[model samples]
Target: MKKLVFIFLTLISTNLLAQRPQTEQGKGSLAFWENLTKLCGKSFEGEMINASENDQFYGKKLVMHVRTCEDGKITIPFHVGDDHSRTWVLTMEEGDVIKLKHDHRHEDGTEDRVTQYGGTSSNTGMSKVQFFPADQETTSLIPYAATNIWWITLDDTTFSYNLRRINNDSSINVKFDLTKEVDTPPTPWGWED
Candidate 1:
């Protein structure tokens, strides 16, 4: 009976510790997420390349325009393809983590892409974001490869979306250093209504 009581107490203590959020640095204020979102309002450019030896067709060059208002309304223009034809929407998913959801949008305000995509803030508090592809199962999304890690670094004026795509377990990784463009280009490729 004494052993059973000690085991129950240990289990309860472990459960309580697990319930607590990680606060080694500070409270889970999620300041990193906010800072990353700020990159959207201005004109920025980035690239998405394949991390494979076979060379897959990923967005090579992209111009991102993140627009936001005082009322908290926001929109991010994501251009893709060689002609820069497609536009993907980036919206904030209100929660503790400040998740960003992406989807293809038409002029009529409908979804165009067959699958939805976006990313969630990492709980590790390491200033990282996870990219989520719609076709992937939820269980497989968290442990995303380093290539899927779109490391966004920004200054007061300029920003860089260091998009990386990890193709294999080896060292060959495709990299795109998307620097901010001064002028905004026309609407993306598939902006038609």
Candidate 2:
């Protein structure tokens, strides 16, 4: 009877452990997810701090609205001037992994060819920062962006979204002031008010 009880207890314990997220990275991802969710329903103004004159975002008004937050996903619309086609979607998957996806849409509410291209967090990023490297889907969708790596950092005073291309010197950083909330922009393309 003792032997049977021991075996049963061990099996139950193992199964419970298997069901939990297993890595330190997973815990960090959860922390990051919670921090991001706190910004839901807020909008902030930002600017591309490193954009060159030729960049599309240069000299344009930038706004990011943390519009939606639900059980396992957060959607933030990024408005660049009058164009309302870009959104950033963050999803919390099983094992506590976080996925970042760029959702782009046409003015008529149609998906763009380069839509839904981003990656997942692969390391133990902190509660205020996370990094995502280009996933296979991103490479398959945008051949030239195979080496892209994107990161977002948040703090009491600022929130920054950044991208870097591996093996290349190209990069962009957009910083939004967290000290003040801006007027929320119009609904992004394909999303209702």
Candidate 3:
């Protein structure tokens, strides 16, 4: 009787866990992705809340356009002043992972040497926040940036992009106001499609 009771309890426990709500580990589910997709085809003007001396270049017109929204990816072109050479490509990876890559291109539609460098989410974060550690590719492409960590946050009113160096005193944040939609910016470089 004791053995039979133990087996029954074990089965019940397993079934309960199976019925629990899906979470970050639910690879096919993307509540966070859906939140971002809501901004498709929209543009927002952002102000650099925090910046180091190196980020002075972005002091010009800062705009982020949620340009493309597809099955499992989003392409946002970040325009800094008159330079439209940077695009942030976020793609869903292998179920529950989100990968963010910086695609940089030149005027003649050629890949820049310092392009395609970004990181993948380290955990299944909440729908509002996702943290991406420096991936191997990013480290290899920019050796000094090996200890970098980037994250983006999406809330009802504001969407922010942030970068920080691990154990270092370097960081920058650009926060866009989602409450007001701005005029869409021009197409980014190498994006005639």
Candidate 4:
């Protein structure tokens, strides 16, 4: 019975430790998430850093609101001109991995047919930048985009979103000036203002 009790205590302690935030890695990743959370309640205008004439967002009122932030997740609504349907969701995954998802919704709070496509990454990057590769859900949704890699770089001066479609030689980079806070735009589809 004493052996059984010791085993039970060991299991409980191990699980408790796992649930606690202790190591530097945990601190670093949480710091990265906090860097983004700090932008909450603010809106910034973004422009495609690299654009061709055919780019739709090139001359539009492109905005991103680091609108909603919580302890382990943040929801940023990205607006293009008058389209309020795209929201970027970032969640703290197990330990240090961060999950990225694009939540597309209709005006009536219905999920778009093509939505929630992203992945998680344990990117050993600095607290300012993290990369997420296409996950299984993304591939199942968009087979051709299986190699899509999305990365966000956040700093005191800028917050940029970069995407590369591997094997397709296509990339998109949009950078927002953190120094310029814009007027808040309309609430995103499926979200309360």
Which candidate leads the pack in lDDT? 2
Clashing pairs in 4: none
lDDT tens digits, residues 149-193, model 1? 344443454444434445554332222233534466565544431
Please identify which of the two predictions, 1 or 3, would achieve the higher TM-score against the true structure. Answer: 3
- State, as a TM-score between 0 and 1, how close model 1 is to the true structure: 0.48
Looking at candidate 1, the ten consecutive residues that score lowest on lDDT are 130-139
* Descending-TM-score candidate ranking: 2, 3, 4, 1
Question: Which one is best on TM-score?
Answer: 2
**C-alpha lDDT score of every prediction, in listed order:** 0.46, 0.90, 0.87, 0.87
- Model 3, 1-193: lDDT tens digits are 9999999999999898888656533532267788899999999999988564567755588899999999888999999888899999998888578999999999777899999999999766777888888899999999999988989999889899999998788787899999989998888999976
Give the poorly placed runs of model 1, Cα more than 4 Å off: 1-30, 37-40, 48-60, 69-73, 81-95, 106-110, 122-180, 188-193
Instruction: Give the Cα RMSD of candidate 4.
Output: 8.0
Clashes of each: 7, 0, 1, 0
Q: Residue 165 of model 4: what lDDT?
A: 93
Q: How much is 55 displaced in model 3, in angstroms?
A: 3.1
- The estimated TM-scores of all candidates read 0.48, 0.85, 0.84, 0.84
Regions of model 4 farther than 4 Å from truth = 1-27
For model 4, what is the error of residue 139's alpha carbon versus the real structure, in angstroms, after optimal superposition? 0.4
lDDT of 4 by residue, 58-126 (tens): 788889999889878899999999989999999987766799999999889899999999988855455
Order of candidate numbers by lDDT, starting with the best: 2, 4, 3, 1
